[model samples]
Target: MKITEGYMPYLNYQTYYRIVGDITKPALVLLHGGPGSTHNYFELLDSLASDDYCIVMYDQLGCGNSYVEGHPELWTPETWVNELIALRKHLNLTKVHLLGQSWGGMLALDYILHYSPTGIESLILSSTLSSASLWASEQHRMIRFMSEVDQRAIEIAERTGNYESEDYIIANTHFMHAHCAGVYEIGKAPDCLTRPKKTGKEAYLYGWGPNEYTPTGSLAGFEVTD
Candidate 1:
């Protein structure tokens, strides 16, 4: 399998992208989550690359190799949607299959609905939501199953807007282990999850608020459901 990588110019920023397998084959584009998460985590799917279709992954505007700062305003879904369009145009990806996870799933839905771009062969959404309110409600429901100590930590953190407290951090870690990524301990997770030297924390904060259970940012009431 051949691997190629480069930066695609999008507006004033350059999006770093990687392609595995033959570029001439149909494209299977992978979209990550966090609205700020990097594509590194999707490296696990690179094995899907073959002669049928190439695997395409890229870090969005403000994370990983495409890291940019001092632009919280650009953390909106529209910003990322336009960047996706730019990537497809830059790569001349006429036919594609999209696989989006979590926030990435939300982005994929937004793109398909807004532009209805042609040549979308298939779409696969994993662990995503169409309504922000529903997402928050579900998170709260999940939190209810946690220990009272963890619950108190989260409640206090939410009330004080102090997600940096030790208790809050511990509680959040517990939640992540139970729901997000619990297969391995802190440092034992795959390299893709830990290798990024920088992350789009600002973007995450601006777009998603303080933590997973809270919805205070631009996505506060975001809904695309009918």
Candidate 2:
């Protein structure tokens, strides 16, 4: 039940991470979604901490509690892949299981396909879409399910390229809470919202757009399915 927090320097940035449970046990690394999301969403996985597994969670560069400086162009998939490798080596973990949700899964696959890390023992992809095209399709479907007024407003907003409109943001947030988390709860716990910030908000907006479903950022053209 021991928890430790630390930082690992990688390339031009540093990753903030937490290790929970017995270090002597099998290691399980959890990767959170959002090229910008913090590890706070996976707090539930801490329950898995025990003698059987050592859970490791981290905020990637430009997100959560990780180092947020240096180069913005370095936020590509390849950089993230190398960051994970660096963290593994820093922790001295020989072999371990990987669990990634959404973008995390994408990064995990990128690592597996490219670097072929020697210590990976298993992988778990949860609530993750394999490709940006598939995610876009799903998002369209979700938009269609929205109220007629909301749908029209969103359509017009996108058509006019007015993504910054208050109406568009409000409608988008509504759809996100309803269809994304599948949890309608309004307020997050004080501690939940009070967690340390990771990366610059601009990094996420520049990389993944305003939300997961809306792919209007640098990753808009990103897709992987074979």
Number of the predicted model whose TM-score against the real structure is largest: 1
True-vs-predicted CA distance for residue 20, candidate 1, Å: 0.6
Q: Candidate 2, overall lDDT?
A: 0.78
Prediction 2 TM-score vs. true = 0.87
**What TM-score does each of the candidates earn?**
0.93, 0.87
| lDDT for position 82 in model 2 | 82
Q: What is the lDDT, from 0 to 100, of the residue 169 in candidate 2?
A: 79
Question: Global lDDT of each model?
Answer: 0.89, 0.78
lDDT of 1 by residue, 84-190 (tens): 99999899999999999998998899899988899999999999889999889999999999999999999999989899999999999999989987665768777
Angstrom error at residue 64, model 2: 2.0
Clashing pairs in 2: 62-199, 64-198, 65-198
Tens-digit lDDT string for candidate 2 (157-191): 87887777878878887887887755534456545
Q: How well does candidate 2 match the true structure, expressed as C-alpha RMSD?
A: 2.5
